[model samples]
Target: MTRGTGRGGSSAAARSVDVARLAGVSQKTVSRVFNDEPYVSSDVRRRVLEAAGQLGYRRNNAARALASGRTRSIGVVTLGTALYGPASLLMGVERIVRDTGYALRVVNTMEGDAAGVAGAVGSLLDQGVDGIVISEPIDEAGDGVDAPLRVDVPVLVIGAPSPVTAPTVLTAGDGADLMARAATEHLLALGHATVHHLAGPQGWYAARDRLEGWRATLTAHGRDVPPVVTGDWSAASGYRAGRELAADPDVTAVFAANDDMAIGLIRALAEAGRRVPQDVSVVGFDDVPVAAYVTPPLTTVRQLFDAVAQEGLKRLVHTIENPDADPLPSSGPPVDLVIRASTAPPPSRTTPARGRRPASPSPADTPRPPLTNGGPAGDH
Candidate 1:
C-alpha cells in the first residue's frame, strides 16, 4: 500500500508488491481480493482487507460502474425545442447531478407527446436507468394529450404548472393568471377606463388563466368585463385582434397574452396611426428573450421561468427519489410588472362601449390569492 500525490494526483510511484508480500499472499490473490472475487479463504480475505485499509485504497467508481451494470444514473426526457425554460432547467439539473455521483442521460422528446415521452423512458429503462424525469409542462394543451402516470422506477415530472399527483414538481400556478392580474392591475393603477385582453387559444392553460385574471380584476373594480378576443398564440392572431380592437378607438389599455402577440398588437396599433404610451398602452406576458429587443422594448410581466424550471426540476427529483418525504414548501416567486416605454395613460378620445353592465372587483383582482399547491396536472 502507498499514499502520495503523483501525476494528476495518482500514486507517488507504481503500485509495489509489498502489500502482497506483507500479507503473505500472491499479488494475483491481492488483486482478486480487491475485486471481491469468490474462492479466497476467509483468513486471507481478512488479511487482504486489513492491508488494503492500511494502504488507504479508494475504489474508483467510474471503473466499477464500467465493470458492473449499475450506473446510478437517471434519465431525463425533454422537449427538443430547447426553448428558454427547458434550456435553463437543464443547466440547473446538471449543476446538482455533477456532485451526486449520479449520471444524467438526456433524451429529447418533441412537445412531450405521450408516445414520444414513453419511448424515451423505455430507452432509458433498457439502458438500466435507476430513475427517469419528464420535463414537459402539458403547457396550454390543456391536458389534451396522453402520458404515463406511473413507471416501474421513479418518474419525476418537471416544468409542470401544478404539482403532479404522482411524484412531481411544477410552477406555482397556471402562471398566466398572475401575469394577467399584474398587467391589468398596472393599467388600473394608471387610471385607465378598463383593460382589454387579446387572449391566446382557449384550450391553453395559460390562455384560460390569463383571461380569468383579466375578468376577475375587471369585475372587482366596478369595471365592465368585455369578452376576450381570441389568438392562436401567434403574432398574426394578435395583429388581427388588434385591428378589431383599434376599430373601437376605446380599447385604451390592452394586455396581450404574450410578448409575441404584444408585438403584433403594437404593429397593428401603429398601422392605425395610434401612438404607444400616448394613444394606447399595451402590456404583454412571458417577457421572452425578444421582449426587450423589440422596437419600443415591451412592457410585460417578468417571470422567473428559468428559475421556475430549475426549481421544478429539483422538486420533481426529490419527489421521485423519496415519495414518502414531506412535501417541499414553495418560495412563491413574484410576478413583476416591467414599466417600459410601452405602457402609459389612456388616450383622451377613448369612449366606453355602450349598454354593457359594469362589473365589480373580486378577491382575485386585489390581494390576489396565490396558487396553493394546486394538485398536479390532470387532477382537474
Candidate 2:
C-alpha cells in the first residue's frame, strides 16, 4: 500500500510476459499456474527462479513472500557510548536476535553526533536491512532528528517519534508517568508526606517524565511537590543535590534519577549525619548493577530494559519490512519496585529518637531465585 499510485488510483500493473520470456518457457506454460496445472514439478520451479534472476523480473513479494518468508538480518542504530541503559538494552537485543536466528547489524553514532546518526542509519538502508532500531537519546540527540532518510521504509523510532512522522516504540510520556506514580506511591506507602526528586538533566525525556511522575503522584496524594534539583546524570550531581536537601531537616525522603546518583546521595546523606533507612530514606531509578551492593542496598525502580529493546527491535523491523503496515504502538513492561534496605518509614515521623537501629527486610523481602548459570543475578 505504500506504493503510491498515479492517476485513476491505479499504478502500472506488472506483466508476466517478462517472467515467461525470461524463464525460456512458453507464455502459455507460465499461464498454467492461473489454470492450476498439476504437471509442474520441482525442476520447473528452479527454471522459474533462474529466469526471474536473468530477466530482473520479480514476483510481487507482497503476495509471493507469503510463501517464501523473509530473510535474516536486522539493522540497529544506537548511541556509541557504552552507557548503562544502552548497554543493558543491547544485551536483550543480542539474545533476541540470536533466538530469532537473525543476524544483527549495529551502527554506532560516531562521536555521538547527529550527522553520524544519519550516516549510520543510511548505511543500514543501503544494505536492504529488513528493519532498523534506533536507541539514541532523544534528549541528547534525537529531538532534532529530521525524519529518517526516507519514509518509504518501515522505521520504529525508539523513545517516541518526533511529532507524526513515522511509527515509533516509546518508553517515555506515559511510561514516565507510571514510573513517577509508582515511585512516589512507594515512598508514600513508607509514610513520607511528600517526596523530593533529584532529576536528570532537563534535556532528557526521562528527566522530564520522572519529574512529571513525581508531581502527578504528589498531587494525587495531596502532597507537596518540592522544587526539583537538576543533575547531569552523574554521581557528582547527585552528591551536590543531596547536600542541598540534607541542609533541610524536614526533607526525609528523596528519589534520585538513577542508581548512580543514588550512590552519590548516600555519601552526602551519611556526611550529613543521616543513617540511610534510619534517617533519610532514598529510592532511585534504573536499579543498576551496583544498587544492591551499596553499604545499604537502594530501593529502586527497575526499568525493563530488555523488554524495551526487544519491542523496539520488533517494531522497527516490522515497519521496515512492511511499510504499509499500521504504525507501531507505544509499549513497555511495567516497572517493578525492588524493595531493599534503602527506604523505610521516616525517622522523625515513625521512630522515637531513642531506638537502637531500624528494622530491615530479611531474606523474605528479596527472595531472588538463583540464576541458571549460578551468578550474582541468581544469588540473594
Which candidate's TM-score is highest? 2
| Candidate 2, pairs of clashing residues | 154-319, 154-320, 371-378
| lDDT of every model, 2 decimals | 0.67, 0.67
Candidate 1, residues 1-380, lDDT tens digits: the string is: 33734336556433426457657899889777765577999999999777656655544545556776456687877668644445655666666565444678988876535466557777887887766666654452446454434556655555344222343333433355766887888887766889888987664455777888999889899998876788876788888888898888777889888777889988998999877767788888876777776767787876665566555555655654456886566676567666666765555533235675534333343232232211221121
lDDT of 1: 0.67
Candidate 2 local lDDT, 1-380, one digit each (tens): 22323235565443457657656787666655433356876677667656545544434534433453544567777767665766777677778766554668898875435477568777887776665666655444545555534533445555544322334332322376677677778778767878889998776666777888888889988888888888877889889988898899888889887888888988998998888877788988887878878878877777777777666665665555455777567555466777777777777555644656645545453233121111232133
Counting clashing residue pairs in each candidate, in order, gives 10, 3
Give me the runs in candidate 2 sitting further than 4 Å from their true place: 1-71, 110-116, 140-149, 162-174, 315-332, 353-380
TM-score of 2: 0.69
Prediction RMSDs, each to the true structure? 11.6, 11.7
For candidate 1, list the clashing residue pairs, or say none.
Answer: 140-204, 140-205, 163-376, 164-376, 219-360, 219-361, 220-360, 220-361, 220-362, 221-361
